[model samples]
Target chain A: MNSAHSDIDRVPMQLVQGCLVASVQVELSPEVLHVFQQDLLEAVRRTRARATVLDLSGVSILDSRDFRSIERTLEMASLLGAQPLLVGIRPGIAASLSELGAQCAGFAAFSTLERALEHLDSAG
Target chain B: MIELGTMQIRDEEAPVQIRVKVLGLLVSLGADEVLATRVATAASELSHRYQLLGAESRCRCVLHNEYSSLLVEFRFTSAHPHPETTDLEGIAGVMRMGRNGTGTDELVVQIKLPMPRDGLSKRAIARGRERILQRSRRELMDELRAKNAELEAYNETLEETVAERTRELTHANEQMARDLSAGSEYVQGLIPDPIEEPVRVDWRYIPSSSLGGDTIGYHWIDDDHLALYLIDVTGHGLDSALLAVTVMNVLRAGSLAGVDMVDPDRVLFALNNSFQAHHHGMKFFTIWYGVYQPSTRELVWSGGGHHPSILISPGTEAPAMLEATGPLIGAVEDMDFPAERCTVAPGSRMAIFSDGVFEIIRDNDLVWTWEGLVEFVDTLRGAKVPLADALLQEAERIKGDASFDDDVSIIEAVFP
Candidate 1:
C-alpha cells in the first residue's frame, strides 16, 4: 500500500463489486485540486466502471478551488455515465462544502470507503 | 697699510683669520663634505690676505649625511720662535650665531711665538672647542630623528593600501551572494505549482536548483474546459528562467482570450513574434499545450520541440506518444499548431512530461522509452490511483535515485 502523503490522494485502486473504490489522500489545496480535476477525469475513464467511491479521509482542509474541482469532476463523471460518490468527508469539510453551496447532493456521500461501497452495492 | 695682525698668527691671529679658522674648526667637528670644503677655503684665503711669513695652516674635516655634526682639525706655524710656547688659552666670551646654537663645530689653539706666557689664549681655545662639540652633537641627533620620522610616515601609507584592497574583495563576494539569492527567488516565482481542482488532475514540478528553465500554467476556459501548457526554455539558470517566464506570460494572455484554435495557435505566434522582435537574439523556448474538455473527454494538444506526451488506455499494455507536428515554438512566426485530439475512455490516463524525463541516461543507455511509460500506466489501470504519486515514483525509479539533471515537470490528466 502506498502510504499516501494525504488521505484524499487516490493511488491504490480497489474494486468493490462493480464499483471502483479509491481512497483519495489529497492536499485539498487549490494547486492539488486543479490537477485533481484532470487526474480524476482520466482515472475514471480507465477504471471502466460506472460508479466511484472517493475517500477524502486525508484532506484536512478544502479551499474554494478544491471544492470547484471536485464539483467539476462529479459533473464530468456523470457525463461519462459514471457516478462519483464522496466518502470520508470530515465534519469540518462537510460543513465547509455545504456552506459553499457546493451542490454535492447530486452525488452520493458516505463516511468511509466501506460504507460507500455498501451504499453502492445496495443501490445497485 | 693694513697690518692684518696675522703675522702674530693671532699673535694669536687677527679677527678675520680667527673667525675663518673657527668656521673651519666647526667643519672638522662633523659637518658635511660641502660645508667643510667651503670653510677650509675661507680660512686659507684669510691667511693669504694677512701675508704672514711662515704662516702655514691646514684644515681637514669629516661630516655625516645630514650636515648636522662636524669634526675639524686646525694647525698653525709662526716664524718667530718663542721660548715659552704653550697650546693653551684663557677664558673667552661665548659666541652665538643667529637663533641656532653656537656656530663653531670645534675649537683650535694657536700659541704666540713672541715669548708671551699668558694663559688667556689657552682658555679661549679650550672654551671654543667645547662649545663646538656640544653644538655638533645636538645637530646630528636632530637630523637623525627627522629621517626616522619620514620613514615611519611612508610605512603607514603602505599599510592603508593593503587594508583597502582587502575590503574590496570582501564587498565583491557579498554582492555575488546577494545576486545568486535574488536569481533563485526569481526562478521559484516563475514556475507555479499545479493548480488544485475537484477533477482528477495532479502535477509535480521540481527545479534542479533554486532556479530552473521550466514553466507551467493552466487556465480555465469555462466551467467544463481547461487549457494547460508547459515550456522549457533552452538553457539553465537565470537566462533560461527568464525566457520561461516570458513565454508563460504570453500563454496566459492568450488563454484569457477564450478557447479557440485561434487561441493556442495565436499564442504560439505571439511568443515567436515577440522573441524575434526583441532580437537580443539569445533566448527561445520549447512549448507544449493541451485543451481539455471534461464533458466530451477530448484533449486537443500541440507540441513544439518538446517530449511527446503519453496516452494510455485501459487494458492496453503500451502507451502512445503524441509526436510533434511542428517545430519548437519561438523558432518561427505565424506557425500552425495543428492540434491533435485524443478521446480518453473513463479511467484512462494521459501523461504530459518535459524532456528531462526521457533524456536521462543510465549505464550509457536511455533509461526508458515512451512505450515503457505506457506499460507502467497500464499497470495502474485496474487500480484507482492519483496520477501525481504514480508518475513521481516512476520517474524516481527510472532515474536511479539521482536528482533530475534539469527541471522536471509532469502533469497527469485523468478523465474520470
Candidate 2:
C-alpha cells in the first residue's frame, strides 16, 4: 500500500445523464482491479444508472485473469439492473483474448464508445 | 607649538599606538571623530610604510597654531635604509614630505589644516597626553575578545548549516529505503499462492537487499494444464522491475499474439519477437517456462539463457537435469527454442531456481556453480524442512548472511 499510491488512485468515473462510464488505464494489477470493482459498483448503485460502460480504450495490455475480472465486474453491474456495455477494446487485445480462449461471447462489446452509447440510448 | 608624542616605531604594535595618539591629539584640538580619523589614517600609513622596510625609525609628532591655520608634522629619522615618502601626499590632505638633508635618512611629513574657532592652548594639549597615557592593557584584551566572539558566531552558523544538510541527506536515504521495500512487497505479491489440490508447491524469493527484479509463479493455463515461469531481468531497480512485471503478466495470462498458449516453445518465440532488445533499452532477460499436464504427469518446458531445472524422485537413483538451451529472450529474434518433455513419476519432485540461488560465495571464498548446486540438491533426502526452504536456508548459511547480492528465488513442486 505504501508504494502503490499512484496505482491506487481511483478509476476515473463519470455519470453522463443517467449513464455511468468507468475508464480503465494500463497496468491492470490485482489491487487496481479490486479498486475498480468497488468503485464501479458503488458508482452504479449511487447513480441508479440506466446504462453502464466500462471503457478499455486507455488499456493496451491486459492478462487473462485481469480480463476475466473485468468481465465478471460487468456481469455484476448487469445484475444490479444496469445495462452494461464494454467499449473500445483494442483490436490487438481482442485478437489475443480470443486466441487465449477467454469467454468473450457473453460480453456486450462495441468497437467505440459512440456506438455503445447509441445502442444503450436506443434500447431505452 | 606643543610636542604631542614621540616614540620609536619598533614593531607592528607601536605604529597602531602611534596612530591612536595622533587621533587623540587632533580630537583634543577640537576636531570631530571624522577629522581625527583622517589624520590618524595618515599617521598610521606613514608609520606602517616605514616599518615594512625593516629599519628602526623614530617618529615625533608636533602641533603648531599659526595665524589662521594649524600644522601637524611627523618627523621620522632612521639610522638604516628608508622607503621613498612621495605617496604620503595622498594619505594626508594638504600634506607634503621633504628630506631634512640630501644625504641623510631624516624625513618630515607635515599636514596643514584650518585652525579651530578657539586657539590651541597648553591646557588642551596636556589633557590629550594624560588621556593617551591612561589607555590600559585591559582595554586591548577586551577589543581582542570582541573579535574572537564574532569569529565564534560565524563558526556556529557553519556548524548549523552542516547539521541541516546532514539531516536532509538522512531523510532522503530513509525515503529510498521505504520505496524499495514497498516495491519488493509488490513484486512478491505477484506470485500466485501455493497449489494444494494437484500437487504441493511452494517457493522462496528474497529480492536483492537493495531492489532487483526476480519473478516466479505457477498458475493454471486451463483446467487440466498448469503453467509455471521464472524470469530474471539483466539489471536491477525500477526498469528491471517493470519489465519483470510486464513479462510475468504476459506469460501468466497467455496474452501474446499468435502464441499457442499451451506450447512452451511458441510462448518463448513470441516473447522473443515481441520484446527484442533494441526496443527495450537494450535489456535482455532469462526465463524458464513450462506447462504441466495433470492427466499425463508430463511437463513441457523451454529455456532462454536460463539455468536447467532438476527433477528427483524416490525411485530414480540419480537426479535428472532438465536442460533446454536457446538464445536469451530479446537477444535474438527468430530463435527456435526446442521444447523438452518429461513425464513425472509418482512421488517425484521438480526444483527450479534463478541464478542467484546457486551463484553464491561460500566460506572458502569460492563460487558454487551449477554443478555444485546440483550435487547439493541430490543429497537433500528426508530433510526435516521442505526442499525449497532447505535450499534457501543452505544458500544463506553458505553466504554467511541472508542479504544476498542478487535475488535468490527457488520453486519446488511435489507431484501428486
Best by TM-score: 2
Worst 10 contiguous positions by lDDT, candidate 1 chain B: B91-100
Worst 10 residues of 2 chain B by lDDT: B131-140
lDDT at residue B238 of model 1 (Cα atoms): 72
Candidate 1 lDDT score at position B181:
57
Model 2 agreement with the true structure over B1-416: per-residue lDDT tens digits:
66776666766555556666766676666655555655565566667667777878877667787879888777777766656545444444555445653555456766676787776666776776575454434356667889899999989999999999999999998998888888889999999888787978888889996778689998888988888889999888867888888899998777898778789999999999998989988879999998899998899999899989888877677788888797798988899988999999887888889999888966557677788887788887544467788778878877888888889888898987
Which stretches of model 2 miss by more than 4 angstroms? A1-124, B1-16, B19-154, B362-367, B381-385
**Candidate 2 clashing pairs?**
none
Question: How does each model score on lDDT?
Answer: 0.57, 0.77
lDDT of 1 by residue, B1-416 (tens): 10111222332223233434444444333343333333333333334333344444322222122232112324333333211211111111121111102332323322111211342244544544453333332245557879888888877887888788888988986776676557756655665455545346667777764356787777776777787778888777677777787667766665334335334555555555566524734766787887788788777777777777777777676666766565666666767766678777776777777777656667778887666765676676566666557766787889898477777787776666
Q: Against the true structure, whose lDDT is highest? A: 2
Query: DockQ, per-model, please?
Result: 0.00, 0.00
**Cα lDDT for residue B324, model 1?**
57
